[model samples]
Target: MIFMTVICTNGFSRPNTDPTASQQRTSILVLNLMPNKQGTEDQIISLFEETNLPIALTFMYPKSHVWRHGDQADLAENYVSLDDISDQYFDGLLVTGAPLEKLDFDDVDFWSEFNAIRDWSQTHTTTQLFTCWSAQAALYTDFRLPKINLEDKIFGVFENQLLGTSLPQWFQIPQSRFSAVDRTDVLNCPAVSILGDNQATGPFILKANNQNTLYVLGHPEYNADTLSTEYYRDLEKHQPVKAPENISLTAPQFAYAHWRCCSRYLYQEWVKQSFLLKENNSHEQKQLQF
Candidate 1:
């Protein structure tokens, strides 16, 4: 029942630990590409509520990017300007998704800077997780295989595989995005493993070869009311977002009332796996304590 609380403000964040510590803290840097800066940070933090380990979150805004919709520049609280983060380091990285066109990644203003962090995470951070659009961003940057554009937005509480610890299953995922990533042959990129996929949606979860990096194509961090908020917003804007596919067993608007909770077990499990591979002997001792 122990939870790891993450502190997020305008720019910089470190885990909100109680006191003195001997072990090296696990830090998570979130590349927030949302217009609602503080809200984005809050959604990501919701995921760490059940984690017992220490976690810190830092925000990296794409200062150079053009807005596809709203602007988050005014709402940011703990934002770290690109120049200020040039020498930063962390143990974990969580890339937040944004509503951006996939083909335009190369044209974003801060695209280069985000690429630097992604490249650094490979060797520096113990683990990395890409969410929704961020997963698209990472895949686009890594393999040159672009994220696919969709005819309609895929919005709902998606069912993702909680790939168990054995041969097949890898983890759990929450995917809430308009566009979906195109499925590719796993053999092409052994480094990129497709952990989960939705028959209705696209890739729901993925990870790199080293297993340090994880990606969720949906929004597991979304609160019960998130989908409702989107529904109202789209309706007002007159953007025709159809009712999400799976949830209409009852009334047509029923999915709005049905809320989803984040999968804490999967996150904590991933952390344990990464810690095991990174710090062998120490990891065993930690497990013993657990």
Candidate 2:
């Protein structure tokens, strides 16, 4: 019987340990760039727990970024600074999406720091997972792919067709973005493969040919109310935002999470692949010692 465990030093919930299970816990370092720090933490931690794998999570924030929302004291106490983990290693790295999609890559305050972390991850981490804007950032940095701004935001629950058999044939994924990478550019790049695609949203999931990196272009980790929250938040702020498609504004409860299963499947697959890569590397090291 496989047992899952999540160890977070912060004040988050910790599950009971199983004595029978004996597996090396995978360490995942998350560089969360989201404005709602606590909400993003909850969403990511819940996803890791559902994977049923022994995992240890370490949350990180950029020192170069200025905090506008949330308590600064809590951040300093709970999350590690970039300088804190510069010499550390992890089995996996997860970089969350930020709200900096509207600005040019070079215009962001932490662009240099972000690039430093991205470059560091290449050698320090075994596997990397990037979501939403971070996915766009990775594509731009690695492939020089430009982001095309849409006249309207792709805000809604979208049904995406899976190009690979790793996940279900079709699944719903939530998208809330004003920019996207060109599909032709992604297809033209030989080093990347599109795992999932949507008719309106273009490529939803992409993987590097070497299998060390995964890019998720949508918010599969989003809660049922996430879209609704964003919609109302924008309206309250008087931003030029339209109502999210395929979701009812009158009855927000109708936004059932149809993509939860797919989200779990995708995360579990990533963990499994990371473990496989670790094992193969270990085997190679032992062979070389002979």
Candidate 3:
């Protein structure tokens, strides 16, 4: 098993729990699909630290895809192969977005492996969170929805309004994708609850059965300059992109990230709900025994 230890030092402390005692830790597996695996890892670790939940985060990479970003040797040493962890169950699963939004789901290099992982998640994980392309893939694979290609890339900080749920009212999140899930297709899914959405971006967050899974279309965990970095990279490549809204392209250094607050809230809520569901299920099993 890939073990991850992260220290939470953001003023939140668990004073009641004894340091020597074997506290129950939430096990979360992250399927890292981003080319910049290190960057994505850092972002998630930083965000989860605020929740103060004891988390054993195992990083999983697709063995089928030819990794191109970091040294293969280093990745092998640090991360677990997706196939190796397929049999193991976890309290939570997080699937990151890849840059393969334009390609059909079946056309991606690691599509078969991803599909297998998706199948494993249905029974293995208590709660699953799918981001960006992964979210689109979930909608397509699990719900038989089609991903709609946008006229232009949705690359900016857009507003998302919560749909009268336990989630926060409204927030802005960074979006960088070539395609989006059809709003109509999502509405047809009987098990999904639209937690949040945006006018331009269609749907932002979809919760399956209010407990099993969540799909986030935008990158809420994005750092302040993630959008700026993408914009500059696109500019260098001459890939027709625009500056992120509410951020000054002339001076991105001074821009503040307001999304981190909501992002933390989203994850914290998921972790909290997952634990509650586990506890409730355990209690139900105990009752059945009697």
Best TM-score among the predictions, by candidate number: 2
Instruction: List the candidates ranked by lDDT, beginning with the highest.
Output: 2, 3, 1
Query: 1-290, model 3: which lDDT tens digit per residue?
Result: 22233432111122123343323777788888889987887788877877777775778888888888767777765677766676777778989999998898888998898888888887788778899999989878787878888768887867666556656556666789989877787888886777777777888788766347788897867887788889989899998887777677666444444677778778888887777766776522321110
Positional deviation of 200 in candidate 1, in angstroms?
1.3
Q: What's model 3's TM-score?
A: 0.85
lDDT of 2: 0.78
C-alpha TM-score for every candidate: 0.76, 0.88, 0.85
**Whose lDDT is higher: candidate 1's or candidate 2's?**
2
Q: Global lDDT for candidate 1?
A: 0.60
lDDT of 3 at 250: 65
Sorted by TM-score (best first), the order is: 2, 3, 1
The top-ranked prediction according to lDDT is 2
Which ranges in model 3 have alpha carbons more than 4 Å from their true place? 1-23, 250-256, 282-290
What is candidate 2's lDDT per residue for 64-126, written digit by digit as tens? 888799777777777887798899888788998998789999998988988899899988878
RMSD of each: 5.2, 4.6, 6.3
For candidate 2, which ten residues in a row score worst on lDDT?
281-290
